[model samples]
Target: MMESIVDSMLAQETPAPAGNPIESAEELSSIAFGFMASKALFAGLHVDLFTLLADGPKTAEELAKAAGIPLNRIVTLTTALASVGVVSISDRKLIQNSSAAQNFLAKQSKYDFGDYLRYQIDQQMYPFLLQLNAVMKGDLSDDAIASYQHWMADEEQASVYSESQHAGSLGPGRTLARKVDLAKASTLLDVGGGTGAMTISLCNEYPDLHATIIDFPNVAEIGWRFVSEAGLVDRVRYIPGNAVQAQWPGRQDAILMSYLMSGVPGEAVADLLRKAFDALAPGGKLMVHDFMVEEDRRGPALAALWQLQHMAFTPDAHSLSVGWLTEAGRKIGFAVDDVDNLIPAMTKLVVFAKPS
Candidate 1:
């Protein structure tokens, strides 16, 4: 009876027109299996495989012995990694990290963000993605990522998330500091500033500048530790509260909202922009950095993917665009001053200014 039911369903399927037949299904197949590649990369990070290869090349047997895994298991892992160009195996059967892996995945490199990849992206977000369908269909509540307060309720988990996120954010923070001119602005507010990474970067760039970060209490605690480490205790401070509802200090010289928009529900975005406009001094700049798709929303796969990923957590998440922000800012009595890519195609920086 089950076989007949299945056959009936299969018989209802239609074939594509011969003229419109696909040249190849390679692209579709690649995307379908993309998760497997990501898992391989995560597995490599979990095993500290990249770090081990950092010291020098090693044979499979040597790696297995060093990592305390069986030889067959190590070989399988290395083969998967090698296929993805993250690592390479030589004719001599010695393995080493690719240059990109050596730079960013190895623990020894100054630019290494291995913790970010291993902890935040892999362990945290990866598992959360499984519940994405539920989130989209509005079937799930008690979301860990969408509701920031709920997620930060646990101090230990918050520390792990923030610390890894800080590692990922610092480099981009420095990039923003260099790209945007905050030289003349002495006061800045970093709203939803995770771990004060952006503030630290800006303060380091401008010695005269002082930054106040508004975030959840647990998040602020972690930010304070990072600020102390950066020796910007005097110049950098935190206000513990929800950024959307908290009373913001008026007449700020500049405001930064990095990775803030897409994380919040769609309706709150306009309010956030309004808040920034209200908070800024005359001619003050508000920089919004987040995953913004192209105005036409055609390509730039990474940006689109990130926005979609955020929707999995944030049930009412808005899909952002340059046009959307410009329209929203204009309605709030602000002029769009500048727009640029902050992280290549993955994120954008849109600067809006209140009239002086």
Candidate 2:
């Protein structure tokens, strides 16, 4: 009797909903207008809209004058921004940072991710989302190659993201800069360090620690410019070369691989860790910091997706497991400890040490 009842239900055929086509149309319309959101956000950044709104709400004329956008465009930009609730409009007048923007978009928050958003948008990750079809067809899109070569050149030079290391800056590198222990080590080698920001931060923190910034010649030039301007030239030395092929020239009490090693092949990551292990003094510590993944390779959807993209564009791109890294460091005879959630929503840090 139960089998017969189940069969009856299984054999039933339902008609498609009458509103399926309308729902499909609305979805397509939403997809089509998504870029409007991109422009609104970027234009907001371009015009210092967030900065202007920082103080208080302003009339459209005041906002336009402050942001330098034309008066005619102000209404449309405001409407677009407000539609997303970048501002609140009561009495048809403007106010700043409606709840969502106040928390995330404002320049003052620890969560100031707006710069990164605009950077990715202008850097073509946002624009390139539309060209996934082309990318699937092997187009080798600009965003792919651009950031790759940008890093590839650094990898070529053994440079680190040093300049990208300011404590107050807006990313994992900076986050790592502020928290990672820079003391107890007098000589630090920042391999593939970009901008020398990390070195600068460490120099300030440890006072005794001096660092070398190595990367591709051109990128190192930029790092040099920054460090010079930053008045850190005496403490941080910039070296131009490739990390993979060139022998990183220096011995140290400790070595930092901050936010480096992403997209490096599994074997190469092992090799690099081994190299750093050998370079460390008998009791030196090696800090391996990057966007860490869950041990099961789940959760933190964006970082996991990024692990794949890191592989997709670069020649030897891939992510390392923190567990695997700790195990490998142990195999090389380093005492290892895992520090989870160091960078807040971006990375977990792994620490490996060689006893003297």
Q: What lDDT tens digits, residue by residue, belong to model 1 across residues 285-312?
A: 9999999888767636777888887777
In model 1, which regions exceed 4 Å deviation? 1-23, 142-146
**Could you give me the TM-score of model 2 versus the true structure?**
0.73
Which number leads on TM-score? Answer: 1
lDDT of 2 by residue, 1-356 (tens): 01222223235553122223336777897768877886888888767777678778888889888877898898888888888767777785865767556655667754555655555434434543544455556776666554544644544322233222332232444445555665678898887776676666567667788888666676677678777886777888877776555576556887888656885666778788888888887777788777666676654554565565555544355566677778777887889754655543345678777878
The per-prediction tally of clashing pairs is: 0, 34
Candidate 2: where are CA atoms >4 Å away? 1-39, 65-73, 83-85, 98-117, 124-147, 150-179
Tell me the lDDT of model 2 at 180.
66
Stretch of 10 with least lDDT, candidate 2: 1-10
lDDT of 2: 0.64
